[model samples]
Target: MALLELEGVTRRFGALVALDQVAMAVEEGEVRAVIGPNGAGKTTLFNVITGTVKPSAGTIRFAGESIGGQPSHHVCRLGLSRTFQITALFPEMSARENARLAAQARHARRWQPFGGAGVFRQAAALADAALEQLGLTSIGDTPAGLLSHGDQRLLEVAMAMAQQPRVLLLDEPTQGLSVEETAQAVDTLARFLQASRMTVLLVEHDMEVVFRLAHRITVLHRGAVIADSTPDAVKADPAVQDAYLGGFA
Candidate 1:
């Protein structure tokens, strides 16, 4: 069975259909990229899969369990984690602290009156490991707000990873980054993927990054899938070219 599956999923906002009978399946350890022009329902798809937005219709399954409309926190606890397009961090907190909090969320006793010192220690270890994986160990003590924008982006990814999720959804991870920063983030992520073989569903505008990391590309246009295939195949597809990749190919 596919690790993540969405069948005939639809979402509407009044008269507007943000997602129209979308269907896709992501295999275990597969890196699937979802790309499109603005307002093509890319982010909405992520929100729905992550349970931030309830689907107007259809079913979503992760590890063969129905999860549609279950709620964000519940979905997250089921081993689905994601990073947002906009960096969301506690600016005043140190990088390590920020990551530690995310790790703690995965602990079963996190809500207990006294989760205990062991829980905090374990969370710290996981956080530090995530930071190291993202090459942010040196700046672990720095306030998240003081880090460079590139580092901040990387930090958000590290925080997500600290949860040790089975599926990671990255929404425009390299958005607002300079060329150099983008390259750095991509390289770091590439290395992590190689080591972890993590399943990822990415929504990225940078075609270069999308092509480099994706095993399969699924293109969306006007709230529906226009093309879904290998990167080269999708690039050469006439429909994809006319709709979004006119000059990128």
Candidate 2:
């Protein structure tokens, strides 16, 4: 069964029809990229899946169970997590502290903030592991606000990883990064996903990052899917070429 499925999903903001009968299926352990022009409802799709917005119609299923309209926290508890287009981090806290917070939140069912030394130790270990995996051990003690933008982005990923989510939704992970930084972030992400085997659905505008990391691409236009295929097929698709990739040349 597909790990995450959206069938005939639609969301309308009063007079605005943001998404229309969208259907998508993400297989387990695959990196699926969602791409579109600015107003194509890519962010809306992520919001709906992550339970930040309820779908006006249709069903969303993860692991074959309906999850549409569930609360955001509930959705997150089900092993679904996301990072935003803007960097989301505790600026005043160190990178390791930010990660530790996420780890504690994830294991809160067993965590006691003021109760035991062992719980804090476990959370710290998880955060350390996540930082090491992202190659951020050197800056683990640096304040997030002091880190470079690219490092801030990586720290966000580390926080998400500390959640240990089975399905990760990354929205514009490389946005605002320099060319060199973008390349580095792409490499780190590809390696991390491969090592963890986490199912990923990312919304990205950078065609290079999308083509480099995604096993399949789903193109959205006017809040609807215009193309869904392998990277090569998507690049060759006339419709995708006209609507989205025309500028790539």
Candidate 3:
């Protein structure tokens, strides 16, 4: 069985049909890219999977158990995690502090009673490890609010790693980053997934990142999956070229 499965999942906002029986399956330790134009329900799907939103129909099964209606915290505690498109960091805290906080959360030990233990020890080590992996170690001590825009983006990703989730959901992780920053982020993520064998689902407009990292790509158009195939196959689909590339048709 696949590690994650969504069958006939649907969500609605008044008259808006955000997801129309969108079905997807993610196997263990694979990267699946969900690509589409704006308002295509990509983020909504992420929210649903991560428990930020509930589906109006169908079922969601993770590791063979139903999880469609659980709260987000419940979902996170169950080994699923996500990073926002917007950098969600504690601006007042230094980057190292933020990462330490996340690592502390991951320990899931009696430390929970202490408010925020593990901030200065191995938590710091985990933070430094994550920062070094993402090439953010140089600015590790800087306040998140003071870093450059691209560094802020990388920090959000590092924070997500703090939890060390098995299933990682990233929403527009490379948004607003320069080409060089984008490449760096991609290379960093490639190394992480390759070594950690984490299952990743990324929502992005950048086809290059999708094509580069994803083993299978699903195209969402008008709240429905128009195609699901390997990167090369999806790129060659005439409909994908027409809808995604426009006049490149």
Candidates ranked by lDDT: 1, 2, 3
Q: Write the per-residue lDDT of candidate 2 for residues 1-249, one digit (tens) a residue.
A: 899999999999998989999999999999999999999999999999999999999999999889999998888888898899998899999999999988888777756655677778888998999898888999999999999888888888888888888898999999999999888888988888878888999999999889888999999999899999999999998899899899473
lDDT of 3 by residue, 128-245 (tens): 8878767788888899999877778778778777766778898998998889988877887788678778788988888778878899989988788899998888888988886674
User: Local distance difference test, per candidate?
Assistant: 0.93, 0.91, 0.84
Error of 3 at 248 (Å): 6.3
218 Cα displacement, candidate 3 (Å): 0.8
lDDT of 2 at 103: 82
Give the winner by TM-score: 1 or 3: 1
Q: Model 3 lDDT vs. the true structure?
A: 0.84
State candidate 3's TM-score: 0.90
lDDT accuracy of residue 185 in candidate 2: 84
Cα lDDT for residue 152, candidate 3: 83
TM-score of each candidate? 0.97, 0.95, 0.90
In angstroms, the error of model 3 at 141 is 1.2
